[model samples]
Target chain A: SQTIHQWPATLVQPVGSPLSLECTVEGTSNPNLYWYRQAAGRGLQLLFYSVGIGQISSEVPQNLSASRPQDRQFILSSKKLLLSDSGFYLCAWDIGTGGTETQYFGPGTRLLVL
Target chain B: GQQVMQIPQYQHVQEGEDFTTYCNSSTTLSNIQWYKQRPGGHPVFLIQLVKSGEVKKQKRLTFQFGEAKKNSSLHITATQTTDVGTYFCAAPYGNNRLAFGKGNQVVVIP
Candidate 1:
């Protein structure tokens, strides 16, 4: 079966510090990858999605950016973190297209910016 | 941008009582997907609904896609404490990205 992995599990950072969160998927190739953030007790906000290697689509223009270096490796990064950037970050992958498609998610990483 | 809206930001119910959450979309969706997120966990895909007036059930949970294909609902019979979590309905925005609602947080008091 396919599985997704995300790291640092939890992170604490100071303001203006750089941020890097990694996500990797096994058992799938050319899968659609997405980056999402959820504030405390709030809905998820889509930050970025990549269709293929080196192709990313930004949903919300913010301090954060996303890149798919390899087919199954996606990275979410920020040059400088803001207090508002603190949240539960998630990485998801979908097998194919359309609104009806199902998405599998990773365990997620909780980041707190001080 | 397509907008997805869910009703009752929060629902509190006693265990064994029924629970339901509704999702509406600004535009006609080709399909809708449901996800459940535990208190401290990531969102997990529950089910997907396609076709107008489609009805699907998984054990005690019943999912319905509106005849107009613009809304959906998730109904759980005999709610359990394990059902406590945020239920989000997501739909594709264009071709790839999905737009999620604020989600309805279900709290089951056992």
Candidate 2:
């Protein structure tokens, strides 16, 4: 079975501080990884996605960036956090070659930028 | 640009009642997938439909893909309190990337 793990389940940071969130998947290799954010009572917003190592695609321009350092390790980072950056961040993985592939999500990390 | 839209942003239903949510896309899709997210939890893959006019079922849940491949729907029979959550419809366009609908928040009242 495939599973995704995200760190810092919850975080509180002051404005203008640096932020880093990590996501790692087990039981799969060369899977597609994605980062999504959701504000309170709002819908999920795609932030970034990576098909392979060192390859990242930005879906929405914002204060965040994503990186794939290893086949199953993805990281979302921000040099400086903004008040609007407060939201729940999620990591997902999908089988790259399968038809009608479904994304599996991690527990998610909630950040509160004050 | 491709866009997917879901109707009834929020729905309240009595336990054991039937419920359905519709998803529409501006452009044709190769396939459509459904996901469910419990309150305060991450989204979970529910099902996927590919062929035009295809229909698949899982227990009390039924999924449909439109003949035009521009729409889809998820129907649940005899909803339960455990079904309270937000349902999202995702469609993959030309790229492997998926675009998700705004989602329909379902609240089952017991």
Question: Interface root mean square deviation of every model, in Å?
Answer: 1.3, 2.1
lDDT of 1: 0.93
Quote each prediction's TM-score: 0.98, 0.96
Model 1: chain A TM-score against the true structure: 0.97
Backbone clashes counted, model 1: 0
Error of 2 at A83 (Å): 0.6
Q: Which digits, one per residue and each the tens of the lDDT, describe model 1 over residues A12-106?
A: 99999999999999998889999999999999998889989999999877999899989999999999999999999999999777344798999
What docking grade applies to model 2? Answer: medium
Clashing residue pairs, backbone N/CA/C < 3 A, model 2? none
- CA lDDT, candidate 2, residue B79: 95
- The clash count of every prediction, one per candidate, is 0, 0
lDDT of 2 by residue, A1-114 (tens): 888999999999999999999999999889989899999877888888888999998988899999998999999999999999999999988886532498899999999999
Which 10 successive residues of model 1 chain A have the least lDDT summed?
A: A94-103
Residues B1-110 of candidate 2 have per-residue lDDT tens digits of 56799998999999999999999987888889999999999999998888999999999999999999999999999999999999999887545577888899999999
How high is the lDDT of residue A86 in model 2?
99
Residue pairs whose backbone atoms clash in candidate 1 = none
